[model samples]
Target chain A: MPPISFALWLLVLVFDTGGQLAFKAASGVPGEGLGHWRAMAVRPWLWLGIAAFTCEFVTWLAFLSVVPLAEGVLLSCLNMAAVMLGGRWLFGERLTARRLLGVALITLGVVLVGAG
Target chain B: MNTRWRFYLVGFLLLMAIDTGAQLCFKLAATHAAPFAADPGWLLRVLREPWVYGAIAGYLGAFVTYMTLLKHAPVGPAFAASHLQVVSVMAASAWLFGERLAPLQLVGAALIVLGILVLARAEDEVAQTTPGHAR
Candidate 1:
């Protein structure tokens, strides 16, 4: 595998995590009585999140063109870890032992599946 | 950490379901034709099967729901759970496509559930503290 693939994979995580955070922040606000779908569409944060995720999909496609899907999926698991850290740093979300252990399990489990 | 976050977790679960459905349809479509890997007009051939279109629709559905979920769910756990997509797509492939999963993969699936249980417990604690929807 080319080192560039790994580098691109990390970039994929950055965009993905940013997308998630933006989406959450956008959604976290209380909505007016304007109705749910209409309300979400109107938020600038939601639009920003959408743009970030669109970037993620394009970068992901580029990554796939270079890397095998299986390998790409495996590497993409790191996005979970990145987001978890982001949660702590950005949102002050708790990282209790139970949650950390759970994350560890997911990471290992997904890698095993990718190995198939 | 609020009652609102419960709604977010529920939405996260829904997104996971959508994600799994997308993966399944994509796999079914791939076994039939890999339009992305092939030349032009591949869309017509690939789109012949409903699952091809289903795959795209499912992905879109997942994308929308995930953003909605981020609105209230605690960030770390919600993001962690989406990784369940990897485990789910694998399990779905084994069952639907008759693909063989190694014994280790089965173990992997079990581990995923265990992890989810741990995360769920933590979230439950948050849900309990929330006074009510208004609080």
Candidate 2:
């Protein structure tokens, strides 16, 4: 991949992972019904997530403009692994053996898609 | 299926449809505003496309549907079900946009889906084993 495309792809990954993590944090608060939505609305994490997604939306569009839609989408799957790691690091989520195996397989699959 | 199961099934299906539609719209918007530049002009070009709005609408719809579904659905299965859009988008791109994946890429896609399934099962197992665990 060219430098520009690689940059755009990286940006998309960063923003997507960040966005997902932020949303997770925002939603972790305990509530139900309209109160849940209202609570999240007042939180910075939710807004941050929305902002990151807005950035990701643009970056993803830019990335797709440079690569085939199919390839771009496949490559974007790496966000799953990235988010999982973020969860482990930030939220203290346990990375069990099975989860690790799953992450490894996903990483390998992404590599093949990126290289092929 | 029970009404509750039926609700989940419909919700997940709707999520997948919205996600797939969003991806296709993004692609269409990108194509319509081709020759991407890292500039305001390029951004403006993208904004001018109706498909971009379609993509935005899809995103909003998917978000609302996903949040609603997540309340009643298991996180593990819900996560995996949401991602099934990857497959749907791939098929749609091939059929509608004439995008062809290389043989290796096709294999890669399969592996990715399988990995997701494994992860989903792992999540369920972990949740079950860890008493008082909040996911």
Candidate 3:
């Protein structure tokens, strides 16, 4: 509940959003002169994306060191909402009214679990 | 109960949410960015962006959380439960990005939510039954 921990959590969120964007950018590159596997393997951004994912896994382990499993998993689900918001804001992705409603429901569910 | 575990749990949740967000963002960014032309140096060019730093930071947090969680939690349940994020991402992607979702997928999401709720309740019951704990 300390401010520092909360701030850390927020940092995690931002980093996560950025990582995804990087991966997306990397994955979008079309095949260059290299063969399919070779081209993919050679992408610099893709490696960065993979590295980002590796960091994510490491952080997850660190978090687990301090939290109960079930509780951790429940809280982590909040990422869905964060991702949706990030996609809309950063990528200008569309969120239809229906999907927004679904997100709202999920948010409500998160609040319920958090409060409980 | 150690308060540290609670902190860890909250941290894990937040990171997971962020992780999901990152994936979605990546998908969108890929969609908008220009396709890779068959240039020789395109790969090198993509590697040098600032965004890559962000990804690294995110992944570091995730890895730490995972290690901590694995120490105390059942791996099977932990992973099985975490996969729900995939469903969450899929649904959000379809709804927000206009990606198609089959009716079955919708049902699957609903089922996942239901299962999670049930599991959450069950966890609470078990916690309550156990003695000498404040969590």
For all candidates in order, the CA lDDT equals: 0.77, 0.76, 0.53
Give candidates' CA RMSD values in order: 3.4, 4.9, 19.9
DockQ of candidate 3 (2 decimals) = 0.03
Compose the digit string of candidate 2's lDDT tens values, residues B59-84.
99998787766554433334434665
Interface RMSD of 1: 2.1
Question: What's the best-to-worst order under TM-score?
Answer: 1, 2, 3
lDDT by residue for model 2 (A38-58), tens: 988898988998899999999
- How many clashes in each candidate? 3, 0, 43
Task: Write one digit per residue (lDDT tens) for candidate 3, span B20-133.
Answer: 766765554444443766575554544554454455565566644553443333222233244456566776777798887666556656655655454444434434565443
What pairs collide in candidate 2?
A: none
Regions of candidate 2 where Cα sits further than 4 Å from its true position:
A1-14, A55-80, B1-14, B29-50, B65-84, B132-134
lDDT of 1 by residue, A14-59 (tens): 8998887777767766664346556777778678877888999999
Task: Rank candidates, DockQ, best first.
Answer: 1, 2, 3
Best by TM-score: 1
What's the alpha carbon RMSD for model 1? 3.4
Task: State the TM-score for model 1.
Answer: 0.83
Candidates in order, TM-scores: namely: 0.83, 0.70, 0.43
- Tens digits of lDDT, candidate 3, A1-116: 55544554555555565565554445344553344336546777557756766677776666656666546556666665666566557544444444444445544454443333
